[model samples]
Each structure stands twice: as structure tokens, then as C-alpha cells.
Target: MNLRKISTNLKLPNYALAIAQDYLPSTFFQYDFKTSNQVRPAHTDIPKPNFQEYRRKPLENPNALSSESVDNRRAIMSLFSFVGGIGTLYGCKAHLVQYVLFLSPARDVLATASTSVSITDIPEGKTMIVKWRGKPIFITHRTQQVINTERAVNLADLRHPETDDQRVQRPEWLVIVGICTHLGCVPIPNAGNYPGGYFCPCHGSHFDGSGRTRKGPAPTNMEIPTYKFLDDNTLFIG
Candidate 1:
């Protein structure tokens, strides 16, 4: 068939023609419909923000305070800081003072001498053992016969040759360390072969009324410690 006859014979609707034009290839049409549908992006070159300058400038605020008000606020903060520092220092000073008062050395109490006994507590011819500085002390109230017996002892024959008078400040009160001269054993009072004296049962060491070693393996006299009469009756010992 010829072109005019084909065109007249094929009775296409207006909607059909429109649909065919939309599906036509880009080569048949000079311009692409898709390109015409796309909007060109605006060439807007937004200037880069000066972040350093923006940070340096203070932020704008309608309710911003005055410079005088800001300075007053800073002064208040400084006063609070100073007060807090002073309070901390005062607390430390209080703790230091308490430590010094409660924990300081106790040398004076330890070094002072101790009181021993009153004379009324001990009777005539009786002996008492007391502790002083962790050792036994013998405080004897001697009779006249005991004093005479001690004085009559021959110095040449005695193991420890101290005179009876030298061993005592007062002849009636004889004070000596109760430990045996030989083996450091505490001696029994008024129970030995020697009269009015101490006796060590462990080694049979005997001490006279003057605390002189009379017999057995003892080498020296019983030790005498420093003591003084506090008054007529009281005694102080170290």
C-alpha cells in the first residue's frame, strides 16, 4: 500500500499518537525529554565560614549581661575560692595540733622514779619482796640480833667482802635485788642455813643479812639498787 492510503486506512486516536511520541528513541528526536525534565542545580558558592573568627567573637544574645555584672560575678567566684582555701588550711592546722597533743612522746612518765613502800607496812624482823623495773627487790626489817650477826661476820672469810654498814643506808632496813648472785634465781627469805638471810634452793647459795654471799657457787653479793627515803616512812626507788 502507498503512504497516503496506509495513513488513511490506519485510524489512530489522539491519545495513541501521544503515547507513541513519548516512547520514541532519542536518535529520532533531536532533544532528550529526560534532559529537559531535569532542573539545573544553582551554582551557589557559599563562602567557607571563618570558624576561628566566629569562635573569637562572643555569641549574640538579647539577654546578655553588662561588663560590670560579669566582673562582679568573677569577683564573687574568687572570694568563694579564697574562702574555701582558708577553710582547708584551718582544717589541716586543727588536725596537726590534735596529733601533737595526743601522739607526742611519753618519755617523762617512763623515766620518773617509782614509789616503793611505807615503813609502817613492814614490821620488825619481817621481809617483803617488791617488784621494781621488772626485777624482785628485798626489803628487810632487821632486828638488833640480825644486825649484830651481820656486823660480826669476818670480811676475810666472806665470798663477797662488803661490810654490813656499806650495804645499808639504815641498818634496820636492808634493800637488795632478790636474784641469786650465781644463777639469777630468786632466793627464799629467812629459810637458809645462814640466819636472817636469803637462800637459793636451786644451787644452795646462801646470803647473809647484809646480802653477802656466804656459801655455795655464788660469786658476788646481792645487787643494791638506788633508793632514798622520801620522808620518815616512805621510800622512792628507781
Candidate 2:
């Protein structure tokens, strides 16, 4: 064999390299029975397999998993939105709950038909405020005091005394709104310079027992909401 110079920087061959087959032991490196002892170049260890393949299951698009996950989130959100819509509707509707009670909406500004009241519930000479047609109607059962005064008023003393003849129904009964048309105020009944009628404190308006505007700042008389007698004693106002 030809003699060859060895690299000085490299580790000197172990004299036992000729006998060595397994990887060198630390304590064994001190012995020398020289032969070529160059180790094979160190090879780096391979890493574990990535799940990138399993994530992209066969027959599915490469990006299908991520896309489907996003779609599922949106679908869940849409289902929640539909449930909220129904909840909103259920929260808003109102209705009549009983013969005299109602399930009123939390919000105001309602459009409703006429409500009815039994005449027998109220008596002579007394005025009852009942809701009719969403407005307050003052139903006055002319006490003998009011009736006696009506007969006593002189026609010459009155501009429009609002006689029973002017009413659509019987003259003895007076049905008029409690609200003043001039400025939407509840008028005081049968007092303060009124002979026997509705008086509005807001504008000093006067309406006779028949609700005919008599004297006041108001342009029209106390409103007579549209109403019908369901029977001799029950009146429906709208």
C-alpha cells in the first residue's frame, strides 16, 4: 500500500478500528490498534410524518375541510337569527285577555275598534268615563237635578241650548268625550260657569249637557265619538 499523509485536525484512528464493528464506546476510544477508523458521515434523523395528508381526506377538495367549517358556523348563526325573529314577533302582539281586561302591548299608539260598556253599570245623575273607540267617552245619566235644570233654561236665554231634539237618540241621555277638541285636555264636568255641561280648564271652553260647544276658546263642541247602542243598556263606542 502507498503511504498517505493523514489530516492533523481529524481524530487519530483507534488501533482497534479493525476489530470494531459496533459504534465506538467512550472508554474504548483510548485504545489504539490502528487501521482505518473513519466514521461514516453523520446522517440527520428523519422527522415524524405530518397530518397534512389526513386533513385533506380523499375525494374532498384540498381546502374542503376549512370551507365546510366556515359554512357550518354561518348556518348556525342563520338558525339563531330565525329564532330571534320569531321571538320578536311573539314579544310584540297584543290582544283582549278577558271580558273587561286586555293584553295591551308595551308600546302605545294603538288602532282599535269601539269598546262597549253596560249602561246599567252607571246610574242617574252620575257621569262615567269609559273607553270607547280608543277615546274617553263621558256617559252621563242625567240626575233629576240635571234634567230639572234642562227644562228650566229659557230658549231665549240660550244660543244653542243643545236640546234632546238635536241628538241622534233620546234627549235625556248625554254622551260626550271627556277630551277637549281644542287642545286635547280632559274637561271638567258640570262646573265653573257651565250651567250643566263639560268645561275645559285648558282654554275655558264650555259645552252643554249635550256636548254641543257653547262658549269657550274651543272651535268645536265636546267630541261625540261614533257609538251604537247594542241594547237598551249596552252602548258600543268607536
Best-matching candidate per lDDT: 1
lDDT of 1 by residue, 1-238 (tens): 3323332345656665566567855354443223145666666765655556443233344246567366666777899999999999999999999999788657765564465677778888889888776788899999999999999888999877899999999989999989998989999998788778989999999888889998899999999999988887887788
Model 1 segments beyond 4 Å from truth?
1-113
RMSD of 1: 15.8
Query: For every candidate structure, what is the RMSD over all alpha carbons to the true structure, in angstroms?
Result: 15.8, 11.5
Candidate 2 Cα errors over 4 Å, as ranges: 1-111, 148-163
Q: Give the true-structure RMSD of model 2.
A: 11.5
Best by TM-score: 1
Worst 10 residues of 2 by lDDT: 1-10
Q: What is each predicted model's overall lDDT from 0 to 1?
A: 0.80, 0.65
Model 1 TM-score relative to the real fold = 0.54
CA error at residue 235 for candidate 2, angstroms:
0.9
